[model samples]
Target: MASSDSTASVPDLPSKPPAWANGSPSVRRPAFQWAPYLFLLPTVGLLFLFSLYPMLYGVWMSLRTTDVIHGTSTFVGLNNYLQLFHDPQFGLSVLNTAWYTLTVVPLIVAGSIAIAVFLRDSRPARLLARVGFYVPFVLSPVVVATSWKWLLNEDLGVINGFLKWAGLATIPWLSSDFSARVSVVVATAWNLVGFYMLMVLAGLSQISAEFYEAARIEGATGWHRFWHITLPMLRPTILLVVILATIHATQAFETILLLTDGGPGGATRLVVQNMYQSAFGRLQPGYGVAQAVVLLPVILFVAWLQMRLFKQEGVI
Candidate 1:
């Protein structure tokens, strides 16, 4: 009885496994507490290398003046930045890009929303219409630029031929500075409007149709329904479309490079063209980088303001 009681009273001691049988101790973080952070390492590294480093390096380069061949760089403070203000060409580029953004942003946003609203629930339309609209987005920019260039030719182009046949004189589509700039805006809209429309269509489709049906029962006119129901529902998507259009407008390079080359004497040139000229034309790589550096802050601030609008619209 005594031996049994003593055995019952003793707690079971845990035994350690043989060291060789189990394996060596591994220094491992707890999965629940630390595994997520471990998984995030690669993402952090990518952002740092691809996004952060280039931007920061551009800023550093922008603040310095360096010869292309010598590879020696010296800090020039704000001289390069001041040079941009003094440069007439830079001013023109900024104005042209601003005008481009002004033209495209409103037209694309409004046109896309209108088209999407009309098409999202479109029925009994030919399948060809959908394909035709979406096709431009898939086409390579080079192809679009080349095709437009051919069509807009002053002498032998189809557009000019049609105008002549219609008893109208040929307009200089790509000749005069004013006309050329307007042409780019129209071309950009032609190429991009479909893409924006599709995005708006997706957003509109997410909204329930029952809302409109209910509004119908309450004597809402077509315009009333659109203004009160459609516009409010599409606020998020409209905001997104505008933001994206702004970024695209600001970064517009390929079409401009191929089509105008920022020409008719820099009248239609943009900041990116200026950067290219700085880096490659003048071989002042650092100055180009500086312009980019100065531009980024402005972009970020605009993006932030747009995002705040998103927040107000309950998107973010």
Candidate 2:
């Protein structure tokens, strides 16, 4: 009777449901919500002012012939593009760029993969080796090209000196057409391999150790493991590297400019270099812009083709 009286003395409290549960609005939003957009205004404004404006201007310029002397532009339709088809030099530049892409892309992929695999371990020596390989990537392209130019000099280069020391005949690395092309290819690959190695390493890091453990349990050898597991898992990364390398090779200009300057009968002349010469050296802005416009489609097509192939293989 005493416990019942104590319980009855407690006051009864009223229960209320939350606003959201009662189907009423829970959050009271501020009347002024333009803060986020205000923060993004500067970036959006700069992109439109610089990138979009220049691209639109370039397209307009491509359709018109500009007189540099009088600062006047005359609309010429697609005549600039039409003339590019019959220009032998333009054709040669395209072929050279194609060759550079075909050669350098494979070399970079193979070399970077090999290096990344070898240095995948976390040993001190491996870490040092990784740093050594990546150092060249951080250097300026101009500095790298200049250094290679000195090293590949025909008469007094370090490589020729070594060859002479070994009693072998010296080769003209930058003088002959074949050697000049080879030299340029080698220098390009050397400059780029380290950066791609980092990409491969990043891909490797994403692979699960369980896959390797399962392979080992199945008695798979190192070669079998790499072939069946590593390569398959790295397909997306390899595709990315391939596309980037192709674009780099196609637009190659600065290194070739400083190293060979498209010398030895124009063996190393690339499309970008050709465009640059036309625009600046020859003062044909319309023709140069046309070349750039044409190149855009070609690069997009090649990249699209790669993605398509990778999709068919179930890689991407």
Candidate 3:
């Protein structure tokens, strides 16, 4: 009777075996298992369509001799690239681009850093100043370029007018090679400084107030604190800004077009302008695409060089 009672206390098992008994899986999925992928599909599709496809197509086009009028292309392998190596105009454009980049990038970085440091305090005046600096960045490139052109006109521009009023000789501003280069650099830097200042301000904000407090307790002056503490902490942000500025300077087009139009004997024509003329103006699409393709590696090399330098300095 005891044994039967013990047996009766045990629970009965179902007659059917478990789902896994016959080597079939029994894991159940949630109803929303694919919801994340479903949401991501649209973004992925758009990227593939717009970004990836164009890039792949451009590379393909770079290898061919494209006749835009006839809508035909012939495989020319690396001939277009070879042709570019011997092209003097292309070489000149590359040199001009380098000079513009080297000049404007430093100016942008320095000016932005100075302005950002000045405006770090939360005073109302500083806030107003910040807004004033950033206003030009938000304006359309066309509008900014047009305004600058008026200001820097050779004879009747506002700046020359002021020079005359001050009993000083007026500058050529845009008519001469040297002055045209200076005008473009000044205009580009002025237009971009505010945007970069905002970036630096963000970097400044990320630094802890405790740092300044600690430095003050150590009898550090303002310059010492900036040099030792602030600059060291801001390295990563500075690196990012430099790389971006380099790329922007290299690819500058529309502003140069509107301001100088590669004037004073193509003094301001950049690589992109050369590429534009090759593809559309000269009807050599393949050659133009080749220039663009080569530019990608140049940009990548610059960015990589920056990364390496920063790494050596322990910035990253």
Candidate 4:
């Protein structure tokens, strides 16, 4: 009995770890704890130098009144921000930016999805269409703006030439305030639609073929299938596009700069353009920095709202 009790109390010998396991004696991992960080050092350093430093410096600049020519600055606290509130040009710029965003974002989103859906075919025509639409987006912003500027020029423009050929009066495409805004919108949309379409296409590609097949099997119509299956799955991607479009529209400067140069009036003067004028053109860097700092919050708020909406829809 005693011998049997002693045998029962004996612990089982520890089993050997598999050769693939980290604890296995046969495998030895190099103890270079700092290697991963070292590999990441370049990227982290670049981010700090370019992104973080600029942002911090901008914030610092916004709080001071700096004479760029004299290389002198004096801290004025929130006076610049107060001046922004009272500045009519700044107010107009804010309004213009808001209008631009409201008009362009919906058009881009809808047009992109439609183009993506239409181009999903396996035919050569569809392949060509995809390439044609996507090509404009790859062009440099300056090139795009320059081409469009010549095309929309009042007297010398091809558009006006065509109007004359068709016996229609030459429309002031960029001379009138309303028409200038409209022209900018059209030009901006034409430039960006291709990129938005590609984004939608990527989302479309992720959706399983079986879903569409099953929907068709149930005798679902094309519209029904799109509304029920495609749109639902593409929601996340659409939100992403909207967020990006908002940012682009809000900060739109180059296209407007090249196309209208803030127009016959101040119709196309966006906030960024105003900021640019204050910073470099007017030599009021501190005022420009304040305008930029103001924009940061607006952009963050919009982005946060979009992300919140995306999260609600189960999108990361």
| TM agreement with the true structure for every prediction | 0.82, 0.82, 0.81, 0.83
Question: What are the per-residue Cα lDDT tens digits for candidate 2 across 118-193?
Answer: 8776555455755787887777879989899899988889999999999999999998999999999999999888
What is the alpha-carbon RMSD of candidate 1 to the true structure? 14.8
Quote the positional error of residue 27 for candidate 2 in Å: 4.3
Q: What lDDT score is found at residue 172 in candidate 3?
A: 93
What is candidate 2's TM-score against the reference?
Answer: 0.82
- For residue 19, model 3's alpha carbon misses the true position, in angstroms, by 28
For all the candidates, what are their Cα RMSDs to the real structure? Answer: 14.8, 13.7, 15.1, 13.3
- In candidate 4, what are the lDDT values of residues 1-316, reduced to their tens digit? 3242111122333445333334445658734366567889999999999988999999999999988778999999999999999999999988988898889999899999998898775455455655788788778778888998899888899999999999999989999999999999988988888888877876787788999999999999999999999999999889889889888776558878988998667899998999999999999998998999988988889889787875675544
Candidate 3 collision pairs: none
Residue-wise C-alpha lDDT for candidate 3, range 5-65, written one tens digit per residue: 1111213445454433232245354243565578899999999999779888989989999
lDDT scores in order: 0.79, 0.83, 0.83, 0.84
Error of 3 at 161 (Å): 1.2
Q: Is candidate 2 or candidate 4 better by TM-score?
A: 4
lDDT, candidate 2, equals 0.83
Q: Which rank order by lDDT, best down to worst?
A: 4, 2, 3, 1
